[model samples]
Target: MSSTRVGRGGRAAMVAAALVVAAGCSDGTPTGSGTSVPTSAPTAGGSVPGGAGAVKLTVDSTVATGIEVPWGLAFLPDSTALVAERDSGKIKRVSGGQVSEVGTVDGVESSSEGGLLGLAVDPGYPGKPYIYAYYSGGDDNRIARITYRDGKLSEQQVILEGIPAAAIHNGGRLRFGPDGFLYAGTGDGSDRPTSQDDNSLGGKILRITTDGKAAPGNPDGRVWISKGHRNVQGLAFDGDQLYAAEFGQNTWDELNAITPGTNYGWPAAEGISQLDGMTDPIAQWRTADASPSGIAFAKGHVFMASLRGERLWAIPVAGGKRTGEPQAFFTNQYGRLRTVEAAPDGSLWLTTSNTDGRGDSRDGDDRILHVTLGS
Candidate 1:
């Protein structure tokens, strides 16, 4: 287990690299970011060969099975992982290759796309020992803080609420950023206008303290870090650069580089646009190919999970920008893929969403798959 440190100066380099990649000029080559793709023996699943300077990857193993709609995953300091089930509201622990329900989140209204969606452990866990979650409550979406001790979850408290919720567009993905603040992805609650409204909490990425208040240095001292999103379901940080996986309507699905106070045109712009004062997505996919969900960054690339597409996409990140075309893995082999999370062991943990009333569920219906990057 090696330690990976992405410093601020490195972030500037990544941004510069991303700008070059965005300009559509730089060749798809890694810039020695201290992380290298592994060259290992072929595993059970076939390997996907990398393009020039791209990281090669393969499916490692299926770690846990029989999970019903596992939506969120967060690794503990001890390398144990917690998985959240959307429809059941159960928080399951994965340790020693076994999955066991530790607790269920109360008052979660599981409707369509809404449910217990995202989970994050306190950065100072054991000392803090709190598990944070984003879920759909009775009337809206909310964040909760729960205590974890002796392998049990207790002392649940709703720390934040008031974001609009919808059966289909309840954005729910929680993560603790490099700056130690909690950030949340939210949807427009099916009202496109809310994405453009600065006062609305929906359709935006929110930066807040662990206690759920506005984070320090937030624009205008508010929870909004950026605005104008349709339904942002995934948020990841590479060094200091933030990237969001957004669900676009009808036309496109987007991967956007997040900048604070920036407006990503939502209803006004679905995919590519030259609209003034609005930020455009660096990468866009047709709706059928990428109904993107949870995303994770590893090995100089961003891995996005797709529900409708039924695959995992690896988008190369060089210098800080996305380069070349994305490669798809496990296309329709594991039903609907919902989440891709980086693990402590440098592998990726992926959850299948077959039981989410959409996919072709098998005997296990849903399961967690482990992926290893290889050369």
Candidate 2:
């Protein structure tokens, strides 16, 4: 596969072909290095000839620093960002470049990749005044609704529990869909059978009401909207179509176009399997190039944060399908990115994960970067 880079004066510069095979590995350690790509500034918004030519990524500023493995990022109505730290179980508030610990989530147990993993502010916001969190509890991974008012978080109520938990691959990423229901991604928790078992919550994309009941009209009235997943970490919607970023076992990492009642072949297959009764990914990369985590849709593209790959990927989409080849940015410049969220101001907030005991920690081991998009 070939990679494209935006060069001087917004020209599409073709880079060398991607190495055919990357060493097999999970998201633990990087197996290969990335080619350093130069960035060019171009005006954002209007569509260019090719989708990839429509936008460019550039870091605008550093939002916060010295933060530990920040995983989930959600914006309040006031544009304040609540960052969930994976190891500390603390929810920090970032406003105008100041980061402050608002409160610690109770009963959170930090393990390998567990802890406070993902957060979603109530879509109703001030009216609902609740923040939803998915974390590793005593014996299982659970979701809790906490009250956030006047700059403090209080009154945590566990709304859902009992998704299998493990030191690694405890999938945790939360977001409210366009329908205003909470959608959660869970891993197989090292149990491969669970990925194909609808009776189990592990390895599935779950849709439920804010109160934790299965959302109405789900397949068989169960909370599961889809099954057969390995470790899903990124969920975003382009209009009504949902896309997911998943960590593969060894060979391929996936970017899936999600649909209700669809089965994504996980234990059976990694990337593109044309087998019957399974859906293939819209895009895939070698695990070494993309241990992708959180993704956000902005500037006519889906921006994905890669951990082992140590880069940000911009995949152009039209009508929820890939319109062109994916492009990489900031390769090896920032180490092990974990999350990316689109801000209200049309910019993006990206988080690093070097301090997660995975990558080499830098001066500010883990930090949030503000990014602006251009043509």
Cα RMSD of all models vs. native, in order, equals 11.2, 10.8
TM-score for all models, in order of appearance: 0.86, 0.89
Q: Which candidate is the best by TM-score?
A: 2
Report the Cα lDDT for candidate 2: 0.81
Q: How does residue 333 of candidate 2 score in lDDT? A: 83
Model 1 lDDT per residue over 157-206, tens place: 88788777766667899999999999999987766677887777878999
Local distance difference test, each candidate: 0.79, 0.81
**Model 2 C-alpha lDDT per residue in residues 275-366, reported as the tens digit of each score:** 79999988888777788899998766888899988888888886768887777777788899999999999899999999998889999768
For candidate 1, the TM-score is 0.86
Listed per model in order, the count of residue pairs whose N, CA or C atoms clash below 3 Å is 4, 2
Provide the lowest-lDDT 10-residue window in model 1. Answer: 25-34
